[model samples]
Target: MLVTGGTGGLGGAVTAAFIEAGWRTVVPVRKKTSAESRSGAVGRGPGSNRDPKATPAEGDAVYVSADLTDPASVDAAVAVAAGEPAAPLRAVVNLVGGYAASGLVHETPIEDFERMLSLNLRPTYLVTHAALPHLLAAGGAVVCVSSRAAVAPFAGAAGYVTAKAAVVAFANAVAVEYRQRGVRCNTVLPSVIDTPANREAQPDADHSRWVAPADIAKVIHFLCGDESAPTTGATIPVYGRA
Candidate 1:
């Protein structure tokens, strides 16, 4: 599994779910941490030319440095994920995105709208584009994270809604292009994910109505695994009563 945005709130849960399910996960991080950062962490199979990092402790997924928005960087990250024959890249979970609320479409600047589009979709496209060949070879799955607002739009976030809807559309395109060849693509629409950042952003809102990251993670894990082999081009709503 190659999980982009594995260090974020929902992404942390998604990454953990894959690791717990026994997948050899590869996570792309933009920067290195003192404890977790090391070169060639993803493809350390014996006799490999890549430098070997220290053996990761149990349950630790490999981390490779990458700037998700850059095509060259994304390709490098995908290379790391696909380098090991022992752990062929079988799944890709796209969680690298952000939410921005800058008034209505009329009030928002064109630059802001473009920024939202770039932030939400660029990384997803770049990573998926780079990994599609490996996924085709391995007969795997892709789970993209969209949002409920994509379908049910709210005020002050036209750009976000459009970008998220585009993510769903992109996933569907991938599903259509690859299903016969054995790669399945699906999108999960989450509503107000109950992460710390969200809680802090909307403290007065009823957090109980928000979906938990862990719950969404389970759905993503299932979508990428064999259990959802019959599912593709599906838009699953994890609204959690919100």
Candidate 2:
């Protein structure tokens, strides 16, 4: 399994669940995005990216350091995931995402707009392209992490809504292109995931109403597993009331 942004709350739960299920996992991360890494919120080292912290105590796990926005780093991470001597990557879950520039498009800087696109969209494009050869070899699955924001705009995040909207459509496009080849593609659209960013971004909101990482991870595990074989080109929303 290959999970991008795999050290954060949702990513960590997905990684842990897959490990429990006996699937070796490779998590890619970009540690330098900020001083307080999202991975730290889940009790993992930052800047180590996906360096395989201290060797997994149980099922296999490795960290591949890569900045998805950089084509070279993205390619390197892809190489690391597929080059594994094991059965090769059977699934890829893109969990890398961010919300930037909470303003009208005209007010947001062009750079912030591009950054959001890189964070939410480009990783899906680059990593999926990189992993295709191996996933095709394994005849496996491709899953993109999207948001309910794609369908309904939040009060102040026009950029986030736009980026996720693209992801929703892009995942479907990928599914359409690959479904005939025995490969499956899908998107997990969660609403108000209880992450540090969401908490900070909406301080006054009732966080208890949001979906938890474990809850979303369960859906991801199901999508990657065999039972979801008949599924493709679908967006499964796992949003809580928020």
* Clash tally, candidates in order: 0, 1
Question: Model 2, poorest ten-residue lDDT window?
Answer: 41-50
Estimated TM-score for each candidate: 0.90, 0.85
Where does candidate 1 have its weakest 10-residue lDDT segment?
43-52
Predicted structure 2, TM vs. truth: 0.85
Off by over 4 Å in 1: 34-59
| Candidate 1 TM-score to native | 0.90
- 11, model 2: CA deviation in Å? 1.2
Over the stretch 195-235, how does candidate 1's per-residue lDDT look in tens digits?
A: 99989989999999999999999999999889899999999
How far is each candidate from the true structure, as Cα RMSD in Å?
Answer: 3.8, 5.1
Number of the top-ranking candidate, with TM-score as the measure? 1
Model 1 collision count: 0
Off by over 4 Å in 2: 31-60, 200-203
